[model samples]
Target chain A: MSIDAIHPDWVAVDWGTTHVRVWLMSHDGRVLDHRRSDQGMGRLDQDQFEPVLTDLLAGVPPSQSLPVLICGMAGSRQGWTEAPYVATPCSPPGIGQATRARCKTWDVRILPGVKQASPADVMRGEETQIAGVLLEEPTFSGVLCLPGTHNKWVRIVKGRIVSFQTFMTGELFALLEGQSVLRHSVATRGWDADAFDIGVSQGLDQPHALAGALFSLRAESLLNDLSGTAARARLSGLLIGAELAATRPLWRDHKVAVLGGNDVAQSYEAALAAQGAVLHALDIDTPTLSGLRAAYAHLKETT
Target chain B: MSIDAIHPDWVAVDWGTTHVRVWLMSHDGRVLDHRRSDQGMGRLDQDQFEPVLTDLLAGVPPSQSLPVLICGMAGSRQGWTEAPYVATPCSPPGIGQATRARCKTWDVRILPGVKQASPADVMRGEETQIAGVLLEEPTFSGVLCLPGTHNKWVRIVKGRIVSFQTFMTGELFALLEGQSVLRHSVATRGWDADAFDIGVSQGLDQPHALAGALFSLRAESLLNDLSGTAARARLSGLLIGAELAATRPLWRDHKVAVLGGNDVAQSYEAALAAQGAVLHALDIDTPTLSGLRAAYAHLKETT
Candidate 1:
């Protein structure tokens, strides 16, 4: 198919702290082209974003002024352009609340992050993912678990985010495994299911002793000759277990839809299953694309 | 007094992971001279320890084979010489269990660390301090809390270390303050008492929710405009409170003696007081020197 014959309907972008991903969608709801780069908001200055983004969209036809919808950290004050946060107890912000970038070639709009004032929580990209979920299953109302560097647990009632909480699980794990004394005991790569389960149980049962438990991993290596693989698994389990213990109220009664990458989502699934909670895993990419699609449709109708 | 006229009786050293501290003691039990350097075990190889020690002791009179008693990481498996650990449920290892260093000029003995087989815990330098605690009060029986990078909570009964637990409170605090995203919301040098107390109460009340609570600090900074100083104080309080919550069984009914640096010990004292526990703070330097003195006495008698 010639580029001139088949014009892209719109473009979707997920700009995070450390990465940038872009997808071109056909009018018939088909993925035409996809590209990714390390040129994320975290690595770009205000003036640098335009050039980097322009380079990413170089493959697009010169005449095609397709509407590009952006989400995640790109909307933060420090990103491409500030897209003010949309308060919760509301549906995800669409094109109506999006901020426009000063670009001539592309009609670009950046999605706003979601903020909860009372508990003081804010999310940029996950809110769009939730919107994607609501688009696919408009009646889907329950808890949404999005695991990443900073994992988010969201409650949805009648297709709107009610309240949410975030955990420093992923960041804490990275710090412990990479920088803490536990680094000496755990391997950078490996896992042990038994040790993981044991650590999870301990974390759930007695979270106040987390600091002590973390130290024991190192002590066990020196004393009982514990393996690096087992140590890694246990460290992950301990962190995830503590997160689960804290979010019990969110998952105890409601069925959860986990939106994350494969490994992290599986970990959460295993943990939630142990808690006897029903959960379905969903790949983060699909919903993010769907969310961008939904926002594009909204833009078409509103404009 | 001239260095030639007043010869030192023995040298006491506390060589930890990050720093080397040494003190010269007289025959009359008076401190002759004291010196410190950044030549900790963590920064050097096995071969470098002797040279560092010799340089630190260059001021001493020549031809004097001064007896040197050392404790801490300098005796770890990877240290200057492997000082075999003394299995716990016993008194701190004295000269009998001390390992001799292959030194030509100085008669050096490295103190052995204490290890617990079950539950897998170990302590190197703190055990010496614990022995020092016993030298002054032979019948003191209670909990001794040592706060540092790895905080040790020791159980003492009739001048012997019965059991103990290690918490990574200080290490965790340092990591969060220096590396984590929470670093942006915490001042490097400032504190808020109210925020600290509030964090302590919350951490003690719901330690399982610590990960969530930590995130809230960042959120509060963005949403509710929480101060960096307050956030820093609160972060410290939460970690300490969680540790206190875990060690409640050890300190609830018994009087606690906190042996640590001034600031850290004071923090623990405040946390313990809030828990309605009888607590006293002791400077770590005194007990460390005393322990080395006691070890030197044992060395003199055994020889």
Candidate 2:
């Protein structure tokens, strides 16, 4: 079949739980304009999603009638219709099924997330972002980490996602510092590098001793009168230790690319660097848009 | 000063978050009477603590009241007043300040929890339980595993709590199966021994490979058509694997006494047995009560 070159009105939509972003693109897929909203799929009920999308794209010209591709939690079971998960060890722009948005005039298709059997992990929109990364850097082979509430570490083998793992590091931190008894003992200060480094070292040195290490935060405060900042460091060490232990196998010989915000990615980079692993960082936002666009392009080619 | 031996009525209280238990006893520390109420210190405002205690012990003759000993979360800063933490490498039933509970008519003292400095770990009621175990079996030396929301594996030497560690295994299992994406893929069937054994073996073997193994559950289902039960098993394996990695250091050489409910304790026993460690099971509920009573007896003799 001869590929039909279609001029897409909007480049892509990276609609996640906490944020929604849309890109306006030219015929060749250059981003001409962009818009973002905090009305993430996570915050809205299923029925309210269509109107919100319409409201966000109200200014776009109707005559352009561009194909809009969506990805992220917008395709989750709780979001729009559940987009089937594509099996792993598959190429970027892995085959994704299209679901029509509940709007008549807007033709929208959500990209499917990817699932892997070995290591038993799954990713939603991040898979598409990974696809974008693969699209941009086809020769790169190693580990790609997307840090968030449920941090994902994906293995890329020659542009294919072979396997992946998810760590609830961010969520666990939030739960411990915000909800558990440890909250009262810890200070609400920002990150501390000395503490972070101490944590990372301890994490790597005594990964199996995490539970005991966690209690040490309280002990340090009571015995040596360790400051709350130090307590925070101890907590960080416990969490990072668990993460390191969980991710060590996947990262044994591979170089690593971190895809997330600067702060989160930086901590992971430091941890990996300490372990003598080569590291790279990609802007999470751009790759997400690129991935969405890639999926849109794939859809346009097929239908 | 010579130790005073008083034949006063002894009161033992186990004050936790959701419930408060009190035992009125003879001078020999035999339970003459017992009482329980929903007025745990966790539920009451700081100011209401004295009044609630007064209400709970309204009928007890003030003259017969001896020193009241308390344990558990009541000593947390948010509970009553922060009972100071006792540092490690100390004697059995480590030295801690006896803080007065918020009641005037009764002379109340709360037990301080044990703390470690190097790894920053602490535990409150477990120390007292260790004390009770020591009091009961003075020559007993082994790893005492207390499994719960935050499982504790404590080391005992003679009658004192020498060192200890904690695990968030239970909490992690709950979060993964109940809250995370794995929830959709797992089955709620009872324990699967083969799956459990697989998890234990994998956990002990590759403590560091846990995160990657977790993603494989979903991948295996997609690529190999695994059953929901098998998916659940894989998830269990990932968690158990991480836990084993975190806890391997403590269980490496020490003889282990699994202290918890039947199922939880049994699971740990089986896991440890697979690793060729000597394991014993102890009823968690009885030891806690026995420990409280022992504390009461000590208070009666020393006051």
Candidate 3:
């Protein structure tokens, strides 16, 4: 089909704190077009979301009122609209339970975030991705290690989320590398496996010594001329090792399904493999697109 | 004596990364005048150190070629003149081995920082404080916990520093509470002991679970309406608890003497006490001043 020949049946969005991603879908579930923008929840006020969405879709030829299914921080209380969370021990909410945002020319549905009451936790866009995972494999049961800025180690029993924990590992790494004194020692690129292994081992062996271990990076840089590549890898390894140490209960005896971006997922895979665990890597796009499709399907049938 | 009646016999300086503290002393060891400046090592170039010191002392009446004993980052590689490290398992460097900076009117000696070759660690100002502590007690031996921006837990055997480790706990706490996502959940002031104890206990128990525990602060804030005071205390307890978990070998069996500003030192004392560790709280100024005195005495006898 030519660029302007076909019209999108629906739009799937993954809006987060820093970026917004959109996939234009045909009625038959094919991706017609994809778009991205930096106008995320962190940058927009409540009333500005619809206008941004309109602008993003301006290039697409006019069609009948398009169905827009959005997931992620856009559903947060501080985002476009408050799509109150669905408590855990339950299935991920779909179009039937999603909150609706008023728009002049479109029917917009935002998937609700997930919440855990006891320990107090929440997940926005990951829940949709989880739904996508579930759609891909209905019988899969194990721990899902979703690596990202706020990494989520989710425990899935059958299909429902039993429990999950979030780690500030990725965020912490960025802050330390970009702002802390360790920035001088850790390089922005080129990783060393041996250094990473050393860091992981140290972190796992003396998890409590993390604060001390961090300072060693700076000292080593000053005294021993530790390269940035080595420091970067080691820093990653240390944090992931500490995370794995704390999360041993989730993936120790059971097989784990690693999900998320390739680089971060590989890092987790390596760390998990070091512990002698069975693992499988799943492409992140599969679940996210699949979850969005599932949500669209639900919206079609329900309303 | 009136404020301007007595002239300083010598000057003692404790220059750190963020602040410079000067003590003008009489011949009888009395503090004749005291001044502080924001012109710390981090702020000044190597040449600026001499000029800055001269400006800070311009107001005080001068004596002929007064002796200036300097410690802290002023002795670091990037500070004034690099006072090379004295390796561990040795007494803190004395005036006999101090580095003389090129100053026109003052006899300035910068105390060397301490380094541990094996673990790759170093301390600039704390070593001087350790010396002061030893001078006061004369026969004391154990671990000295020095809390500050970068906290140090030093293991002392007899009069020498056997080994020491540094923790970025204070720095981590500041970053998390001031810059990270947890900032919104943690209060700038006020504290809850129960929350702190809970965080500390959880940190010690899981040691590896720290990264996850941090995220819970934000989660609880959203889901449970957790108070900011509670989150603040909990965050502190978690970091300190993790430190304690790592340093159990150093302080579990041996008594610890804590030296730092009032608030931070108290936090460590509480955390340590909860672990059944005996601790003595020493005023921070006590050891810093005493250490400078001991170094001055060393200079008097030698030079």
Best by DockQ: 1
**Candidate 1: regions farther than 4 A off:** A1-9, A61-65, A103-105, A281-285, B1-7, B61-64, B281-285
Can you rank all candidates by DockQ, best first?
1, 3, 2
Candidate 3 lDDT over residue span A185-287, tens digit each: 8998898999999988888887878999999998898789999999999999989889888888888866699987678888889888988888966655667
- Residue B9 displacement in candidate 2 (angstroms): 3.2
Instruction: Give the candidate order by descending TM-score.
Output: 1, 3, 2
**What is each predicted model's overall lDDT from 0 to 1?**
0.87, 0.70, 0.87
Model 3 docking tier (incorrect/acceptable/medium/high) = medium
lDDT (Cα, 0-100) at B67 in candidate 3: 88
Model 2, span B1-303: residue lDDT tens: 343333337677778777888776676657766678988866878777666765656666554245677887788777776787777765445223567766667777788766676665767777776766666677777778877766787777765567777766666566667665556667876656787788767766765545445545545555566677877765666565556667666678777787765677677777778777777655446565677677666664565
Which pairs clash (backbone N, Cα, C closer than 3 Å) in model 3? none
- The clash count for each model shown is 0, 26, 0
- Tens-digit lDDT string for candidate 2 (A1-303): 343343346647888888998877775778866779999987899888777877666656443256778888898877876777777787754435656566555767777887765545567888878878877887778999888877887888888888777776676666667655567667777666778788777777766555445555655676667788867766775677668766777667787888875677777877777787778756445788677667766666876
| DockQ values, each candidate | 0.81, 0.33, 0.75
Instruction: Give the Å shift of residue A117 in candidate 3.
Output: 1.8
